[model samples]
Target: MSAVTEGRPRSPWAAPPRPAWEGEPSKAGLAGKGLVLGIACLAVLFPLWIVIVTSLSSKKTITEAGGLVLIPKGITFIAYQELLSGGQVTRATIISILVTLVGTLFSMTVSVLCAYGLSRTSSLGHRWFLMTLLATMFFGAGLIPTYLLVQTLGLTDTYLALILPSAVSVFNILVLRGFFMGISPELIDSARIDGAGDWRILWKIVLPLSRAVVAVITLFYAVGYWSAWFNASIYLSDQDMMPLQNVMIQLVQKQEAPMGMGQAIKTGQLSELAVQMAVMVLALLPVAFLSPFVQKHFKKGMLTGAVKG
Candidate 1:
């Protein structure tokens, strides 16, 4: 029906030559992408750089520099030394470590159990149970009521006060539940055929398979426990039971002098800026050190648990 169909020469403009880079992104486009990534990296790294520099700086230098330092004129480990060797600070640090370790272990155990149970639909009233758990995420008993409950339970002035009340986070439970639901049902059935009980299957098969999510939620619990101060301050009346954060708050805000500082630093008062920065560094070190090891899996773990179900 056409000139080309009749085997005649078509118009020259009918077909255009393919561009050499037609399927490939342009050099400028790649460069723009690289620039954006570089800027984002810089944005994240700059704050870390500042914290490191400030932490390493001498108290005198930090004070002279107006509380922030991008580059230190003189570097010293004196702040860290003071925090580690100083009596009260050292004790508080130890308390914090103990609390975080114990609390996280407890939290992960309870959360994993609850999540696995909720993941299974065979239980009677399972829908109602799940809805009740989900409802806690949106609404909670008021602080006063929680305080009253803790008081009535005689958990005041004790470590259990810190660990038990906040044992199971609804969000963490949901995350783990979604992850459990993502596990192939065939694997569970096979385990069941092998005479594995629910607990045994969870311990051997489910937990090992869900390491990424477990680690992520473990980190979440650890961070929360490490940073917890409000409950400790409220529940523990004894000064000995105070966590590192509460101690740091007392030192920084209340200007409470460390025990041996009177004899060590003739100035009588710790350098507020140095003390604050030192406490921050101490508080941050555990998370900072461990986060990198688990950071790679964090997004995958969270999304797998959150979005899949």
Candidate 2:
């Protein structure tokens, strides 16, 4: 036996002492937490399960149930087939994907450059610019003014209106700026001494190290662009140009009772509860899949890069 293992008397294997801050959790407390988490998971997942099952359920089963189907009597892809058969839904999906991709790219580029520039305390008028940006977060120019501005700029009925009006999120800028500021100045100074410029250092060093925060912000921008219907509803006059969310609102938000799922599957009917659930699933699936992969960094990024000022 090693000297560390040698003792006056042999003892049974046991766990080492926990730190005071991490005292052993009581079994009841652990059980309670587990129970709470389990219930929470079920609360979130049960509705999602019902939506999926309802969407996949046979038209006869749905008609008989007259509500969300928890246990699908029979599975059918008719809902999906109807939704995607060269219809408005298909076009809207493509439009939404394009908007999300292009908007996220544009937003991230502008926000990153703006955050980097403003993070430099030495930059002239940065404080004023930052204050101006922050001020807009609390107080917005009313809808009329914003609409008139877009109109004056000839962005009405254009995709640019959906993208440009709210492209640079002030909150994301602040988060990124805080993260940039948190970086050690010594690294930047050393890079400068090695013949690197501000842009070079920012691209090569700062950005590479700030992946977690940047990814979280990018996901935020993507989700915002994907889910945004108000902008399209206000700016876009042509139904062809409207994003998926706007199309969904147009289809699902009417006060009239939805048509039957069987009618929905056959005659391009879209107002049924099953159809609505299918649309919801389609809209939610992208973000739902994307979030869990990056969720490990989400909390850390939010806490570490949260703007103190």
Local accuracy of candidate 2 as per-residue lDDT tens digits, 91-196: 8899999999999999999999999998899889998999999899999989999999999999999999989998998989999999999889899999999999
**Residue-pair clashes per candidate:** 0, 0
Give the per-residue lDDT of model 1 (tens digit) for 1-309: 776586976678797757876757888989998999999999998887787778778767877788878877977777677778857788888988998899999899889988999899886777998999989888999899999999999999998998998888999999999999999999999999999999899999999999999999999999999999999989998887888899888877887756655444557234556666677778888988999999998888999999977
Candidate 2, residue 220: lDDT: 96
lDDT (0 to 1) per candidate:
0.85, 0.85
RMSD of each: 5.5, 6.1
Best by TM-score: 2
Clashes in model 1: which pairs?
A: none
User: With candidate 1 superimposed using the best TM-score fit, by how many Å does residue 60's alpha carbon deviate from the native?
Assistant: 4.0
Q: What is the TM-score of each candidate against the true structure?
A: 0.84, 0.88
